[model samples]
Target: MKETSEKKAIIKKLMKEGKTYKQISEETGIHPGTVGIYGGKLKKAEREKKCFNGDRHLCKTCKYRASGARSGCDYIIHTGNERGCNPEVCNKYERGNRNETKTSSKGK
Candidate 1:
């Protein structure tokens, strides 16, 4: 078995080469969840290295950030009512339609 550091390096290389999480898991025999963690760390390290010269906007403007229209802000209400607003603020704040039916139909 490879050392943890070696495994992490392999995961990073694979990720940089655009390999999917499932592909890395299949090649390294690591669980997909574990590979995801390693991949996240590797990406974070690379991003940090790139932004080392004081660029906080690196993360703030990330495509994965909630500020995008299709991001978490579209569906989640962070300030008004909902509680578990993990990101603290919702960039896409849309008014709720009280008359709209809920998506989930509980009783047939």
Candidate 2:
């Protein structure tokens, strides 16, 4: 209802301000879990946003491109235990086909 909307707005702002889940909860009177949930959504949005901030390569080439999703980069997603990397200035770029093993092994 209206109360939920108000809480959502506060959550959005706090998230944009980079407030921690516990901090947002204390300031907004929302539960820490709820703050974390909303914060996660907001953070995902900001991370996957296409940027013109000196990108050296397309996100598609980076392993953190979230290619498994149907919409490609609609939301930043994590693969395995690895956190998502920035498309604009990520120095730890890995290939998308990292899981594919070599089929031939010097059997000529």
Q: By lDDT, who's the top model here?
A: 2
The prediction achieving the highest TM-score against the true structure is 2
Estimate, for each residue in 1-108, the C-alpha lDDT of model 1 and write its tens digit: 778888888898898799999999999898899899988877776765664322343334433334435443223232343434333332333344422313455786
Tell how far residue 102 is off in model 1, in angstroms.
Answer: 40
The TM-scores, one per candidate, come to 0.46, 0.46
Worst 10 residues of 1 by lDDT: 72-81
> Superposing all C-alpha atoms, what RMSD in Å does each candidate have to the true structure?
12.0, 9.1
lDDT, model 2: 0.60
The TM-score of predicted model 1 comes to 0.46
